[model samples]
Target chain A: MERNLHYLKGSFLKDRLFANNFIITLLFVLLALAPLFLSDFRTNLLGKFIAYAILALGIDLIWGYTGILSLGHGVYFGLGAYCMAMYLKLEASNGKLPDFMSWSGQKVLPWFWKPFVYAPVAIILSVLVPAILALIIGYLTFKNRIKGVYFSILTQALSIIFVVLFVGQQAYTGGTNGITNFKTIFGFPLSSSSTKVTLYYVALGFLILAFLFCRWIVQSRFGKVLIAIRDSENRARFSGYNPAIYKTFVYCISAGLAGLAGALFVPQVGIISPAEMGIVPSVEMVIWVAIGGRGTLVGAVIGAILVNSLKSMVSEGFPAAWSYFIGISFVAVVIFMPYGLAGLLNQIKRKIYTQKSVKQYSSAALNILEESGCDEYVG
Target chain B: MLDAICGRVKPAEGKIIFKGIKDVTEMSEHQIVELGIGRKFQVPSVFMGITIYENMELAAARKRSLYSTLFTKLSKEQMERIQDVLQKIGLYEKRYRTPAALSHGEKQWLEIGMLLVQQPEIMLLDEPVAGMGRKETDKTGRLLKEISEKCSVIVVEHDMEFVREYADKVTVLHEGRLLDEGNMHEIQENPKVMEVYLGRGGEGCD
Candidate 1:
């Protein structure tokens, strides 16, 4: 009888895992086939949203799993987008000064922008710059044990600082007007429908890879330590785990993911600006993870797509009402769905699983009572 | 005092020599933990966000460096050690559950199990049985006694009966100053302890 109960428990877990995998597979299929059914413009728009989804995954890692809220991920994303933008801008200039540089009265391309002329260099720097920035910030803050809301406020300050710095640098960074008028990437026209489709697929592919990578990370023992740090830093410290090291490492990785997202976003969107990486957009990235579900990786992806799609759709007709709509929904999500959509789904799944198991256990107990004459003991 | 030993609180004066080499006061919390000292708080503090098994796994991990933790999986022996500790603490059945699901006494045992997996040379427990009932307190006393055979356990408690029953040696403090130090019988006879702690008249605590 005990063995039978154990077998039932084993199968119950297997069933839940299977259901989760099936849902994920279905979502991936829908996303993969979206371009086939949608127009080029819509598909390109999705590619941009997918980039934001990648950024959302990073936020979920730092905020949801590790419990370190970063309100300045936009800086990382902006830096990455700017890196890619610099490369494209240089390519479009055709061995001459970029339009913004010439307009700002710069005679020659800056030494810093020279390296970005190479596609490989630009791509590497896009990811590295943000990670290094995060490393510096994380190392300083975490080592000093600055955390919780203080850390969040610091990140907000970072975003504001970056926006100011970017806007003030007219000659090198294109200033308030920002970098635009991209002609081609890798000898292919940016406006071509075929290029748009390819970039969309590329963005989708990266999203999947990033999702799987993050999923693997959170499942590992290191992931457990991350959660442990979130729960109690003192307990984790006494367990011989350095909370600072783990926090800093995860922060750097999260920043890198944001940077990668930004790199992908610029090509699809065809614009990069200081406004995009300011405090507002950074906070918006966090909302996506919150509304999707914080700790769940899949939830981050869904939340990003779901929220952005809603924004695009709602803003089309009632542009003035878009912020109000998002504001209301975010407040509602915080109050009612603290765990977000994924957490709500999980709660429902657990409810069903428990009910089913309780029924099975009762029936098994009835069989035992009948066979062993235990009914006499049951009053 | 326990916090100072664990490097949670820095000492303003004097040194805390561990194994006659390392000064715990000079180290950070994790560094102190690495130097063979494990501390349990008055409250049973376990990682409530993760499974009991994971809490054990994190403690059992030999190399606490970032790279090792990221890349390495627990060996079979480490897995066996975690299982053994879990069974010893009577939490084997609930290993997959989070600490929130455990009873108060069970959470205390799980925290002990976490320290057990680490096998530190010295275990510092501040009121290990602070909120436990008599039965649970006795059980914890027995567990600590058994654990003491492997490593030295320094426990702070106010319960005279518990101290008399379990502690090998007793030290009575009055206002952060040592009033007496001896076995239970020797302590009960001391006039200083009788006056300062037991409330005059040479009468014993109930």
Candidate 2:
């Protein structure tokens, strides 16, 4: 009887998940067709949103699932963007010094920018640089057991330091103005509408890949251990899991994903700046996860797109009141729906399904009780 | 003593010899666990977010690497072992349930079940029957007795009745110092043990 009940519960969950997957498929299809209906500018904006969605997946993996709340993801994103931008700027300069370097009176390209001239090298460095940086940071912090709000604050401080260093280095980096005026990526003119459209599809593909990657990680035993660590680090540690190692591993992966997103983001957005790596942007990245539903990969994507779209709309329509509107919405989400929008949807779905299951269970129990004639009560 | 053995606290002096190996005092908890010494926390530190089955799976002494955990599925043998432990703990029926859904006694049983899955050479359980009712306590005592047939079982418990009922060899501690080490009957009859419990004036053991 217990086995039968377990089977019933399992099948019910499978059915509900199937339905959710169907909806998600439809959503993806609509996103795929969006560029056909929208203008070039809107499509480009959507491409940027997709990049944010990818970054949001990283945040979800680290903060939502692993319980390591990093407020320095913007640093990873900026690092990746800078890598890609440096490559593009070098390519545009045709082996000469980039415009900013000449303007700042540098004789040649910086040693760091030299390797970025190769597209493959640039792409690999874009991901690896941020991943390595995150490894260093994660090693220092996790090894010391710096966690919770303290970890968040440390990440925030790292972001501040990154931004300050980048802004200060006007010669090597573009500083306040950032690296811009990109013409091509491997001879494909970025200014062309076709390139923009292609880049949009590329961003969407990466987002889908990231979503699947995160989904797989969360479903695996590794993901279970992450949730275990999140719920009780001490318990996880005693269970033979080295919490510091797992924490550092997840942090590195999260940073790598953020870097991948930023690399994709640069060509479409046409610039990479220290301002993008500021503490505020990093905090906003976290808010996207919170609003979408932390610990849910699809929710992170939805949350990023929805929040950024809303931000764009509000800022464009009412610039003066945008911050207040965003702040109030965030507060409202935190207060009224602590689990976020996706969590709210799941709760409702669970309530309805649980009601149906409860009815079925009661009828089954009644039949058992009646047949047994009070010999036993099965609940 | 359990904490020291499990490397939760350092002895500050003296070596911890385990399984004929000397000086395990500097080992981490994970290293100590790897040495086949399982310690269950007093508060029943089961992973609350995961189901009871997954908790046992995590505790199982196999393929603990990150890569293995990421790629490998539970083997038939591991699954059978988990089922066996769950059955022994009387939690097989609720194996799919999360720790939060369990009763306090059930949580204790689940934690014990977790340790059992590790197949440790020695088990140190802290307050295994602290919050349990008489029936649960009796059941746990019986379980521990049965478990002792396979390996050594050391239980740190405050319940004198429980200690008297299950313990074959009892060691009494007072102010972090060993007061007496003997059979339950001997310890109960000993003046030092009586003085430690009775505080110089009480009539007898409760």
Candidate 3:
């Protein structure tokens, strides 16, 4: 009977894993085929949404899995976007100072901009810079045991600080207009349709990779410790897991993912701006995760695409009403569907399976008892 | 005092040397735990988001560094140890369920099971029976008595009857100062204990 119960439990877990894999595959397949049906302009827009999905996945990791809500993810994303933009800007200038630097009356490239002239350095720095910053911030705050909404507030302040820094440095950064008017990336014209489609696929590929990575993390022993920390930091501390180290590491990983998303986003969207990294966009990034399902990786992707699509469609028609609509939807999601879309789907699935499982359990129990003669039963 | 030992609270003055070696007061809570000292809080503090099996897995894990935890799986022995602890705590049947499904006493037992899997050299329990009923308290007492055979068990408890039944030695404190120290019977008979703790003819104060 005990063995039978164990077998049943094992199958139950396997079934959940199977369902998760199936859904993920289906989502990816649909995305992979999207370019076939979507127009070039529409596909480019979706590529941008896919980039947001990657950013949302990062948010879900820190907030959903680790219970560390960060409202400054936009800053990391912007940093990556800026890195890619700098590289592209340099490529556009063809060995001369970028147009912005020349307009600002700079004679030579800033020392900081020189490193970004190399494509590989720019790419690596996009991811590394945010991760390093997150490590610094995470170590400072988490080591001192600062957490919960306080962490969120701190991240918000970080976003504000980055925005001000970028806006104030008009000579290096592009001031209020930000970095735009890009010509090419590695000699491919930015206006080319082929480039747009390829960028869409690239964005899609990264989103899938990010999703898998996040899933791996939340499933590992370390991931369990993350959930453990989220639930009870003191308990994890007493269990021999350092909450500060774990939190800091996960925070860095999250920031790195956001950075990757930002890098992917810049080329397709053709702009990297201070406005993108402001507190407003940072909070909106959180909203994407919240609306999809905070902890569920797939939900982040779904939520990002769905919300962005809605915004584009609705805002195009009802520009003024879009704000009111989004505001109400966010409140509605928080109050009515706290678990978000993915959680709602899971609830419905469990509701459908509950009766079937109960019957299966009782019948299996009876079979086991008959076969093994109930003698070992402790209950 | 338990908090000081667990590195949760800083001591005003004093050194806590573990096994005549490491200075526990100088370490962090996780570092002290890594040095083979585990603590059970007054309230059951199992991870509510995960399953009971996972709670045990986290406790049983020895290589708890970021890289090891992320990349490696628990060995067969560690996995078996988790199963054994769960069975001993009588939670094997509900191992897949979250701690939220557990009753108060079961949560306490689960917490104990978690500590057991850690196999700490010394276990510090704070009010392990604070909210337990008679039967649960008796069961926990038996559990701790069994655990003490393998490692040092230090319990900070106020239940005098419980201490009398289970403890090998007793120390009575009055306003953070030691009032009496001996076996349960000697402490019971001590005039100072009677004056400060038990009160008048040993009727019991707690």
Model 1 DockQ class = high
Ranking of candidates on DockQ, top first: 3, 1, 2
For model 2, residues A162-265, the per-residue Cα lDDT tens digits are 99999999999998999999999989999999999999999999888888888888888998999989988877777778888888999998999999999999
Q: lDDT tens string, model 3, A185-216?
A: 87899899998998899899888888888888
Q: Write the per-residue lDDT of candidate 1 for residues A1-379, one digit (tens) a residue.
A: 7677777778887878877777777888999999999999999988899999999989999999999999999999999999999999999989899998888899987889989989999999999999999999999999999999999999999999999999999999999988999999999999999999999999999999998899889988889999999998889999999999999999998999999999999988989999999999999999999999999888899999999999999999898999999899999999999999988988899999999989988887787777788877654
- Alpha-carbon lDDT of model 2: 0.88
Question: What TM-score results for chain B when candidate 3 is compared with the true chain B?
Answer: 0.94
**Considering summed lDDT, which 10 consecutive residues are worst modelled in model 2 chain A?**
A370-379
Assess each model's interface with DockQ, reporting 2 decimals per model.
0.82, 0.73, 0.88
Better of 1 and 2 by TM-score: 1
- List model 1 lDDT by residue over B1-206, tens digit each: 78889998887898999888888888888888887899999888889888888999999998998878779998999999999888888988777778999999999999998998898999999998888999999999999999999999999899878998999989887886788888999999997777776575445533
Model 3 chain A worst lDDT run, 10 consecutive residues: A370-379
Output the chain A TM-score of model 3: 0.95
Cα-based lDDT at residue A171, candidate 2: 93
lDDT of 2 by residue, B62-165 (tens): 76778988999988998899999899999888877799999999888888888888888999999999889999999999999999999899989889999999
The per-model lDDT (C-alpha) reads 0.91, 0.88, 0.91
Q: Flag regions of model 2 displaced more than 4 Å.
A: A359-379, B201-206
